[model samples]
Target: MSWLDQVFPGTSSKRTMIDRSQALPGRTTPVAVPASHVVLGHPLRGEDPESSAGIGRFPGYQAVVLAGGCFWGVEEIFWQVPGVYTTAVGYAGGYTPNPSYEEVCTARTGHTESTLVVFDPGVVDLEGILRVFWESHDPTQEMRQGNDVGTQYRSAVFTVTDADADLVRQSARRFAQVVADAGLGPITTEIAPLAEAGGERSDGKCRDGRFYYAEDYHQQYLAKNPNGYRCHASTGLKYPA
Candidate 1:
């Protein structure tokens, strides 16, 4: 057994990525989502996917998917943000379609624990949102975060548009320097454009990048449990002003 197995028990094999062909065969039906956020009281997922008004229900509202270690803590952080409308935890950046939490834990699903954040663009700039993302967790720790060791815990940013992807790249570049100055290694965040429309393949991998909402118990988990586990390891370096 490797050191990771000795430390984490079942995570030694989970540290590596699983090919789509070898991933778990998730169900066609998605897991049930909550009606509304427990803390924010906002609908969990009533947004119009075809709405031209904006990303969410309202005009000028934007949406971005982020994965930084555990979704519970990450969702909690964004829900408290100034402009955020709602936060939902789920799986993305992998091939499994509507995968279950247990399946994702196996790391064969290729999905990282992710949070979908919808907010008013006018109230909070995307840069500020990105700053919170950078400072909250150490993005350099690939395939793990703190004691959480697995491909499911990997850091990533999945954007809705190419423009947003470009902006994320810029922010990553800036934060990379900040982390470097703080004596950390290079970032390993998977920054990419989410395939919002028609995200499926013959191989059964959800390469389309859709944000599959996690099971009901995981939504606002920190708020629900209050004393639940929350782990986020940061570099303690502030993003450039």
Candidate 2:
């Protein structure tokens, strides 16, 4: 298929990510975005739209942003997992405000294709969630996940709190040795607090930025198109219970 085929299209192996520095120069202005979520019908930013929409927060529900290659599989996996409230695929850890799918695929926006996972801690704690994340793809391959090779496909855990940041780092540290013991080099996952714009500081830490949802076509894409492309590489390592 031509590069013009579509973003994360068919099972064809042609879809691949490129290095950030070697990618196209993305724009300074974020592309215009949709207002409401296609699947959940919630505003794409700020307060929990599901909860605010009157469904009310699921007991112990919390949010975290995850990036591991194409978000189609990542988002689908979480959506099916128990304890998940809702999931939305979007751009994260990037400079552009609301980058378009084309801009992100060009590897210019500095954004990793991300999944916003809202879950109920009562059923699945952070460790359970992180386990699914680690096992989902090869984190050692920096700046890419398998054949999806670009900064946008890089493995990342964008945390909203300092405590969550520490948890991610600690998990990465422990998992690094596990991967090494299994002969993989090391986990190249980026564990950092979400970048924040100026004047967004609170409690001495800038909160996670406004999550710019991806184009309508990308939301719960696999669910909508069951036979679409899916490239997930699980390491088979299990997280501690």
Candidate 3:
């Protein structure tokens, strides 16, 4: 076993994640979220594919950024969805700009580890996307997921458009009932416009101000290292079909 394993003394703290208060200030300089995805072999900020004139085509796809758990597993789940075009992990809903992984972990950045998911509306609607988000993790927890504790691990949906905000809220209401019936606590997932996330009164950068692509190694991490850790704890409750 490694030193970390030895220090934890059979506990998962060595394995568990940690961070500080969200109110703390973050660094002024952005950590520079990079481009280029690990699995997609393209820039993380590329334009969506054009849909042809056909029943299968979906023109002008919309994007939504989400946060749940460690993002390693959350990203994998979305990428595997039938209508999903691409998924990239990053930091959002925080005070820092281009915050680094470590910074976000400290909980000072006020940002949740996030994933940007581009999907075809014709194939999967907003409800479908929300379904995956709700099912993949427990929303009752605030600023934490499973063993991972920090604002970076908070459950949130950062919508790219104003319309998505409404849909996401409605979806949350629908799922909250299921959670209540199951004896779970109230859903505490944060719902906001993509732009509102990652904003701080102290700093100017905010409003989904250009998704900062996570470091190259962190991109599609589960795919690259199949045996790697997956921290997601999905609630297993399906959205009302």
Candidate 4:
């Protein structure tokens, strides 16, 4: 059998949330990733000593994990932001401990294809970062984004603190109204704490929200493969001033 078949195992995108008990039992060890970002040439896992950015609450920088369709473009978009220290694509807001891309694609792992963005709040505030997020995709699509049909493509904001969570919720509400005024559907973007409580269907029983680094090949995919698939269903609507 082909590798794709072995990985996918005849799984289909159900577009429905899987019960926690139904989630795949991922392995203990995390996926191996590159030590540094391909585009930024910065450390992918921890603080950059060379970074002159403000030492925010999370050690040296503030971070947020976001899921909006495919992660390739999402990572690419944030890395270009002025304050962003680094970006990495990963699986977040799910029950899986450390899932693979194949597993997430199956919708059984209950994880979303997400991007971990570490930025300097001094250069760009969370609100500014969220503006890019709000304008980048159609968050009303629920379980999918544009042509990508699966739970992995759902839009979400996985925050690290209650204060950030509140801010994210407030941002979502504002964007929800923005999109609504534009004649779009209600925003389906999931917003919640990444480490404390998971998002919808979490039941507060699942594991603390974790960001599982994707395989090395998936990191900075666009920079590695400049012609790679870039899909972001942006609404062409700007965030409210």
Q: What is the TM-score of each candidate against the true structure?
A: 0.90, 0.74, 0.78, 0.87
Superposition error at 134 for model 2 (Å): 0.5
lDDT measured at residue 167 in model 4 versus the true structure, 0 to 100: 98
Candidate 1 segments exceeding 4 Å error: 1-6, 50-58, 196-206
> Which pairs clash inside model 2?
17-149
- Stretches of candidate 2 off by over 4 Å are 1-60, 196-210
TM-score of candidate 4 on Cα atoms, chains taken together:
0.87
**Which numbered prediction scores highest in lDDT against the true structure?**
1
Steric clashes per prediction: 2, 1, 6, 0
Candidate 1 lDDT for residue 34: 72
TM-score order, best first, reads 1, 4, 3, 2
Ranking by lDDT: 1, 4, 3, 2
User: Which stretches of candidate 3 lie above 4 Å from their native place?
Assistant: 1-36, 40-43, 47-59, 198-210
- Candidate 3, residue 228: Cα displacement in angstroms equals 0.6
lDDT of 2 by residue, 49-153 (tens): 333221223335677889998999899888877877778788876555567888777665667899888877889987789988988888876776666767788
* Native-structure RMSD, model 3: 7.5
Model 2 per-residue lDDT at 78: 87
Candidate 1 residue lDDT tens string, 8-117: 89786789878777888898887777788899888777467434211235446778889999999999999999989888898888877889999999898888999988
**Residues 168-228, candidate 3, lDDT per residue (tens digit)?**
9999999999999999879989887766553443344343334556777788999989998
RMSD of each: 3.3, 7.4, 7.5, 6.0
